[model samples]
Target: MEQSESIRELTQSIEKGTISLPEFQRDFVWDITKTYDLFDSIIRGIFIGAIIYGKPSFEIAVREVDDRPRKGQGKNRKLKIDKFTREEIANKVKVNNYRIVLDGQQRATSLFRAFKGIDEVWFIAKNESDYDYNEILDKNLSEQTLEEIIYEISGNEDKERISIKLSDVYDIMQQNWRESKIEKEIFKKQTYNGDDDEGYDYNLEKYLTICDKLQDIFKESKLLNYYLLDMDVDKFALFFERSNSKGVSLKFTDILAAKLYAGNFNLRDKVDEFKDNNTAFANNFNQEIIVRTLAYIIGDGREKIDKSYILKKLNHEHFTEYWDKICTWYKETLNFLFDNSYIVSQSWMPYENMIIPLIIFRWELGRDFSQMNEKHSEFIQYWYWSSIFSQRYTGSSNEMIIKDANYLRKVAKGERILEKAYFNRLARLQINTKDDFYDYNRKASALYKGILNLVNFQSKGLVSWENNNKLNFNDNRLEDHHIFPKNYIKKRFKDDLEAQDKMSSAINRTLIPKISNILISDKAPSKYLKEIELKNSSLRESLNKHLIPLEIMEMDELFFEILDERATKLFDIIQNILVDKQAYILQNHYKEREHQKGYIEIFATYQNQEIQAHLDLETEKVIYKNEHYSPSGAASKVKEEVSGKATSTSGWHFWKYKDEEDEVKLIKELKE
Candidate 1:
């Protein structure tokens, strides 16, 4: 019913905010290859235009906001929305209450780079026209040569940054190309990758061509603002749905990034920080991966990955401003990578879902998690599962992770006061009296402290949770043999707590000569022990030194024994080091955190607080101000609690290999 928009017209409007980015739009993304091609095309005089070919299928959802309560936690926040689309299997069908993309999710993103613009501008050979360039020298710049002037300027954006206009680059190239064409090639060779490895190759000649063309297009093209599109925003949405006939894919986090960008924020910095700090988090993940991770934290519509609608709701300011908090949730949950609680369907958490609890508790508990704890890890997992079965997201199950972080706020009590971790840690104990507190605190307890005394044994070693901020899992390959092969542990013991205990428990595990552990294959522990003994005569003759004489050497079966023995020796060797952890863990050592206030210390916090909580899927009972209040939002919050009166959730179902009794009861027994 309408004509399509062109690149020049859209870029102009986007720049003026006349065709401002829709809150639901995805982040500014022009990947390395595509970014390369776009500039290359522009350099070659290619124009990118939207070609709307048919009567598009669209969904238009319009609900006036009236401050509805956010789902779950009842922390008093705005309601979150989910989008539903009726796609045609046989024929096209029109729907209502849907949102869609408008234009330049990628190209426009390049147009508005807040950082790369100011940060990397000096690299471009531009003068002061298209860009406002600061003469690097404060005085007498006219007397110095270009090389001298360039040397005087600082290239570091983190330090004092300098801004150079895009147009200036073209003008500089025009003058340079006109006089000394060979210099363009030389300058091009000096180029390095910009902020995005996923960006265009810096070629002075090619870049100059594109900018010139774009400049011309803006000056000559008749394409108007996004506002002047003639069609209602609703129709534009419909047009976007049908326009995606090429099966274009977009991630929800990308959409959130767009919203954040619209709000004048950039995620690249934090993402880069994660990359620079944690190799696994960076090298293993991409922009899309982060988007999916964000969606996972929030939601993408059950397990469907609801990219289309998730962005729509994010358009609202409430969700947009909280992007940093949402990302924090993902990094935190990722660290829970080793928690056994994550093995089950409901006991898990998506990246999006983790945000809810994290925000409710309202602590930057997840920042620079160069170090994190199993409790933080488990809570992240638990929160993820809660969001999934609870249907927290609007996109693919993987994308709904963003749901975890949306609507979380900090209370007056400060970040360290959050009681969840203490309670979660204490949950593993069989408590009886006040002294039971010691037994429950494995993280800071004497045994735990002693286990970490490896650093003292040698000049340096790992301090679990202390330096976990940075992932140095196998930092020392010199010793500390993984009693249970990591691969084997993940496979058979993924859901097994006792199995984890067997491996992590001191008796079954110990530090060995790294070389010996490497040579040991997947044979029984006895076989490996024999190999070790034969390799070193002194070690072979003495059981007291390394091997605690065991009747059964099935390392797999008696893994905990090994863990216990080593832990015993390790603790004994460093008994003097064990005392009040609060006194020594470096006030803000990254592990001991307090929750922000108003969040009922339901699951963790305040040793003095009494426990009167029932956390079934429905009716999340809260113990607040020494009293319990729940059975309020039960029917709506929990699917299990509402699966029918007979539907009961098993708290232990999520726990893996709890004990030997948990094994299936035997008949006369298959082997017996």
Candidate 2:
């Protein structure tokens, strides 16, 4: 059945406990800005879509609507949800016919909050002719014409802009306009002209017309319509799936949770238990990782673990069977990662999906951590670094996941090592240019996290200036302290977002103690570093531990200079990690001849056709036909060009470098 209610009636229903949300419904995620837009659209007579309400045959948990704004962003952010007690719904509240908001939860909640004047303060523009909502409504809320009035402006004395609070608009819409206090106020504000009441009366009429229109906008009950669904649990579930197929669809995990609940298994409870123990990891990688990894493990490392795989093939029974063992494997994997990769916290992980393979490696090796030998450790480290530098898991990684998982199982038995060709490709793709490090986004980029991991590994973890103690992830006090603070850079760059972004680059970031960060807050590095160094005796060691150059920090107001210097230094570190031995060996061979800047020329002969190539000593890439490639990649290309088909060839043995005395030697022989 279909039903219609005024915005006021819907809000009243919410208050009276006749309107509620299912326990499975996600909490209100609308920010204050969204609330502004919702009311703005309603005021303009725009259709904001209809709500979908359902009455289920079976009893289910229900909750009150979350009318609060979004608290934070990223890891620290959440919209709090509170479930209503059964007793309150059944007896005390007297809600025998309450309906669940199957759809439009955000809209319904936003309307309710706006009507009640909760948390956010909103205002309507008095001069409707000054700005057209129709024109700017299609754009972002920040770019809209009504941005000023829609914001919190309760104390604002801008008489030309805001006419009234939106809450007051709702009140006036429900009140008798002629007898309302607002109507009397409008009449009182009327001005006199030459002792004649004509001008005052004209002004009074204009103000009343505006108020009437605002009243009529909310007073119209047909504007807020809803579809009422009355069905059994099974039919209701089907309707829920179909109705939610588009437009902010439920997360696969949520759907899976619902399915498991019906089957007498609680996926969410198990996930909550796991997350309770591993807060850091769970904070970064949520329940999706848990479900996906379980599916992969259950399939013996062959499952795609995509939405289809999870919904159809993921057996809750298998999940329960392997849950405890998988948890143990994850812990062991973390232990190994901490020792080798220096990823002590979830923040440093290059990719969350990397956990799947690492766990699988540990699980496939043995039940005991003692069984992981030197070879296993070496292989795991190689795979870990190779995958990160190659950016293997950046995009669609299902195929790569299966491939790597199978290889890891074999590697566990010492069947083979990750090929040199693999590392060669990783070296080619590794962060090479100074711009690469500078462009690495703040905490969001995998390469940025990879660099952090590398720094942590090399420095054996950074020490804090506060007490010169190594900053630990377990402390919960480690902050992403900006070397050049955000406020300092914002003031320096002043409205240049690009310059601000560059200044706030990951190169300008390092982990420090919360106290140290607070003490150093917003002060220029030149000013703060001096004070910090004066207070700490091991300042040099602390700076070195964070890979911060002492001389660079001493330079006042050279943010870009610091950025460039740190970028070069970080690139050097990354290059060392992904250093191709053949490239380095050839460069070193050329260095011996004092040809530091010039390219290393190597030659190959195939069927009397001589091929010449130049190796860039810095980048370690071969230049043939003006295109750069890794030695092996170039070798394959050259062979394919001449022979019309190419197989993998050892570039070391194929190309020969000529000595100054006319002696030619294969690079492989030179290695000896």
Candidate 3:
């Protein structure tokens, strides 16, 4: 049956315990801005949307009060619904008679809260024509004030305030006009000029008249129109789905949540509690992920496990049974990821959905953590790296997940090894190169995370450089440090953006303690490396732990050659770890050359200190105090020393030396 009711009657029904919200409905999430817009639309004679109601079992017809107030109510205060108790309502109503709001919850709650003066709802004053609802202006009133004037105009008692009709805002406006007339009369007697005074009075009268008209427009009750569905629970679900399909306001998980709620199982709340309890891994955990995991465990296929099927198939008993097992396997899987895989937390995890299949595989292994052997560990590691390198889950189809899930199930049962085909699929994965490994957007990519995992595996765990103490996942002491300091690169490149970017890529980044990063502060790798070696006895071992090539410690300058060598070494290390290859020799990429070959020493005095540099006449390579530079680049360093700031200098004009004739001449003059 369908019927129409005024906003007043609807609010009254809510107060009298005839209407309520169901437990399955989402929480009141509307902000004050939306509330303001809702009332603004109503006041402008605009048609606000309709509400949908469902008749549920009387036992489960419990309603939660709409405690979310608009602005000007005390922070975190909810409007109390005093007249009805759940017990009283249950006793009074039968199963088919219980009405629960299926839609328009925000509207009904706003109306009920406004009418009862439980919260202040604001509106633009008619006197101000250009008011925007978003701005914080003075032209607003509390719903309580609006209600008081309405009652005074209608000559209603204080007890009538609770049940005051929405239509009464019109009568309240009429009373406001009557009060304005009395003020106009008093002002007319005090200053009476025929034209100016009467014109002023007329405009004042017009403004007051507009205020009344605005109130009249707001109180119109046709805005509360709705369709009443007197159907059973199953029929209501179908109707809800069909109505919401095009709007996308509700998701499949929401319908599943509703179904679980009807069965006295609050899935959403349980998931929330799970997240709260496991706060360490809760950053990326959400209801959709939980439902997706549930679907994998019991769903026939990805497509079938959608909204419609879940609404029909999911029940409290099945959900509870599977949820418990999933929870157990989920915790175990996270432990595997952290302890073995080096994924420290959810933030470092690239694809959260990847855990779903792992959970399924773990379940098939009899949920026994002790059964995991070296072969099994290798299989898991191989699968993890291969999936990451292959980008297996990025835009994966439902059928793909089904196939992978089946494959993993076989692997878990020792039926197969991760084959050559899987490895070949990732053979072209570009992670071996410096450019590929040193990504700027590494945090969001799986390869970056995989590299971190490999580093963690090599190091046993991350450690603080300051004290050589083991740092855990929860510690905030670690940060990404540029191996070749950014400032040094900037000095080296200056205006060359491409070079700066290359130097600052992910290959240069390593996790070091915050204290160590700060202490390193733009110092050259040559300086910091020696200091660390002096402080720590196990210098070579510690350097290797960070996946740093031992050659970097001895290098005079961090060149592209160093970065490329280290990146290739790290990639090989990851490859060996993934394939369980032992006794694989690491290839040395370092090349030997004659020291200071084909170069002549040039001396300069800057800031009263003698600086020496060597210039390679054949290659045009200038070495300033063992650091490589161009001739002009060497002059820039000298200029920095002289001015205590970076400035461009002409090396030809800056450098002078005694030529073959035993006369001092500038390099520029000699070249000319």
Number of the top candidate by TM-score?
A: 3
Cα lDDT of model 3 by residue, 1-672, tens digit: 456577766765776777877555556766656665676566544677788876543224244547554455554664332232335545545642546788788788876766665544433222222334653345343321332122122212222121122333433543544655544543233222124333655544533444454454444566567877665445655666566622546554655665566556777778887778877656555566556567766763334444445555567777777775777678778777777635655556657777777877787788566687665666566666666766776674344455456556766776652233333453435465445776643466666666665676666775655556665555555566777888877886678776586675667776666654347767778778778767776766766767777777777464677777777877776567643332211111112223334656666777787777776766666678678877788988877877888788778776766543343445554343
Q: What is the TM-score of each candidate against the true structure?
A: 0.29, 0.52, 0.59
| Better-scoring candidate (lDDT), 1 or 3 | 3
Candidate 2 lDDT over residue span 39-101, tens digit each:
777655578899988765443455677654444433234433333333443442344667778
Please state every model's RMSD to the true fold in angstroms.
22.2, 17.4, 24.5
lDDT of 2 at 559: 67
Report the lDDT tens digits of candidate 1 across residue range 1-672: 334454444444334433333444433434444544444344344555442222223222211111222234543553233222324210322232122235544554443331123222232333323233555434342443333322122232211212233434444433444424433443334334233322334333333443444455444443422222334324444555555544664343544453454344445455777678766556443454444334433432233334554455433244444545655554554444322222111111123233334433334443443354544443343333333323334344332232233212221122222223322332232222222222322322323222322322222322221111221433333234454565556565678875654553334433333453335545555666556555555543233433344533434566555555544554443333222222332232223323223332123111243223333222334433344434332222233333433333322221111112222211112111
Regions more than 4 Å wrong, model 1: 1-249, 259-263, 268-270, 277-310, 315-356, 364-517, 529-672
lDDT of candidate 3 vs native?
Answer: 0.59
Worst 10 residues of 1 by lDDT: 663-672
